[model samples]
Target: MFRTQQSRSGNDLRFSLLILPGLRRAGMVVRLLMCSVLLLALTALSGKFGEAQAAGSTAGKHRAASSGAKGRHRSVRKKAALPAKARTPARGRRHGRAAAVVAGATAATAAAAVAASPAAPAKAITTNTKPELLPRCGFTEASRRHIFSRGVYVLDEETNTPLFERNADTVAPIASVTKLMTAIVWLDQKSLPMANRLEVTEDDLDNLKFTHSRLNVGASLSRADMLHIALMSSENRAAAAMSRDYPGGRPAFIAAMNARAQALGMPHTHFENATGLSPENVSTPRELAELVKAANRYQLIRNDSLDKQKIINIGRGQLQYINSNRLIRYGQVNATVQKTGFINESGHNMVLRLLVHDRRPVIVTMLGSGTADGSRLDGVRIAKWLNCSLN
Candidate 1:
């Protein structure tokens, strides 16, 4: 019975060992499954936590983007609400404001940006000033009414003020009216003897314009007689001889003529020759008005200029030369000093210092009259106008 028991025990022990190994293996497999279960639970928990974190981050980003958009919208609305004039900033200021607005600024920040911007320049305001009233005589309109000369200057001798004028400052050839200047210059010389006889030679002839002359070469006349005939008849040869007999000759005489013009304040007057034959002898009516006043100072000029007719001695016989100015003969006007000039280029020109209605001293200087008798007609019209207006 003991041997059987021992053998059974050994078999039992073998079985037990085998069963133990199996048990151990079963336990290990169960433990491994539990560990796997634990690891799966932890992983599920970690995944849930990560998903929550991602959702929170997305919500924050949305909030930030919405805040930025709302800020920009508010800024635009506020800017739009401003007045039309205020919203449009000046050139330089607008550029700065635009740069600040582009930089993702808030409404309050944009307002500050605009406030910090530079001020624009102010606009200028103009004020109206009253104009001056020109001097007017009662006869202003009447003076212009009857005058037909292309250039006319009427002056009040008492005041030496201009009464009426048309192209008065225009420079034009004065033609034989230049004799007035010649007569003035000749008489100005204190040393030259007026009674001294000056001979008319070939040099006295008008070679430039080839104008007709009644005074022949080799004829002799006193300086006073030459001047008288020159002024009265507009004798070309007599004027030439007067210039030739000047102390320093024609060139000196011409220089004196210009000097005398300047002294008389004739800014636009210029003389190229002694006689008026050259078209270069030019003056403005404004200047000639002053010249007429100056010429009227001399008694001889005033007398000779208005003389109806003058008797001049030729080579052997006396020749009577009528005044070129018809007004001196025909007109009822009492002219103190009168000079007439004519050329194809200058038209008809005249300068008259006359007493209107035997009371007022008026000077009428007309240039570029239409016809040969046009200037005389103008003079008569002016006199009639003055008489009617002054009375």
Candidate 2:
């Protein structure tokens, strides 16, 4: 048995040796196939890991998403919780926005109230009162400048405190500012409420040529309207009616005007007509300043002096009339109150009360100048220039 087993083993060895070369070739081919399969599997695994790392980094690489499967699970839950408001349709979005705005406003208001508790300072109140007087003007013998001024005077409503008295006290015809007195007298004693109707006839429009009036016949006006036109537009008809409708007639109104002048200590002043159309009507610039002060006391005239425009209802419709004083046009003080008058007798006359810088109030009256408008424009220009220079 031993000998037979040995013989078979030997034959098997001899058989194995004969096929060894072929078997080794087959083994080399198998080893190559196994290595190719391992390389392909490794490449696939590397691609998967690279893609997972890229996706994780894109999600902000936040600590909440970077801790393995637990972080990814939390990220998914958070994404499901809320989204942008725009994800919903725009229908009724305005209402939702309004509600959110109201909520935000409520929160802001609560915060503001808490911040502004009880210790805040109050705001200031202001009024259009007189500004401080500027430096005293020296147009005296010592100073040769300001030749056109002739002299300087601190002309006031109370008295002409003669700072430089040339012919300043000389009484002369003061023009349209005379209407201011006319309005004042009418307001004092008339048909109670002077805002009455006026029967404007052709007779009333007779000699108001150099002057202008848009008022027509059968035009109804409140006494307020008449006064407004009289002081603001310098309307002749309004002045005539105010004068004629006095206790008596034109005479009474004129008497009242003179009486008021006397009451105001205007000894050199006299008014013949409600309007200063007649060269016969005269007053000193000094006295007229005082007259203005008195007339302005009634508030109605002062209110009229500042009016920019007025629309009076005629029988047909409304007629627009603008104030003649250029200063208070549209409430800008080119001229706070100004009266312009020119009659053939009185060359051209003006009384202008203007606002100046530093809240100063200035009064200028011109009796006669060469131009038709009676240029106290020089005086106004001087005042404004001085204000600009000083301010």
Which candidate number has the best TM-score? 1
Record all residue pairs in model 1 with backbone atoms less than 3 Å apart, i.e. clashing.
none
**Range of the 10 consecutive residues with the lowest summed lDDT in candidate 2:** 120-129
In Å, residue 358's CA in model 2 sits off its true spot by: 5.1
* Overall local distance difference test of candidate 2: 0.64
Q: Estimate, for each residue in 1-391, the C-alpha lDDT of model 1 and write its tens digit.
A: 9999999999999989899899999999999999999999999999999999999999999999799779767877889775332233556877868855755366678889875654322121011211111102223333445556899887878766565678989999999889999999999988888887888899988888788887888887888889888888888899888888888999999999999999999989999877787889999988998889989999999988888887877657787889888888776578899888888889899999989778788898999988867687788877765555443
Per-residue lDDT tens digits for candidate 2, residues 18-130, read 88878999999999999999999999999999999898778765654457557456666888674333232445989778777877798799889874553311112011222
User: How much is 182 displaced in model 2, in angstroms?
Assistant: 0.3
lDDT of model 1 at position 301: 96
The TM-score, computed over Cα atoms with residue i paired to residue i, of candidate 1 is: 0.63
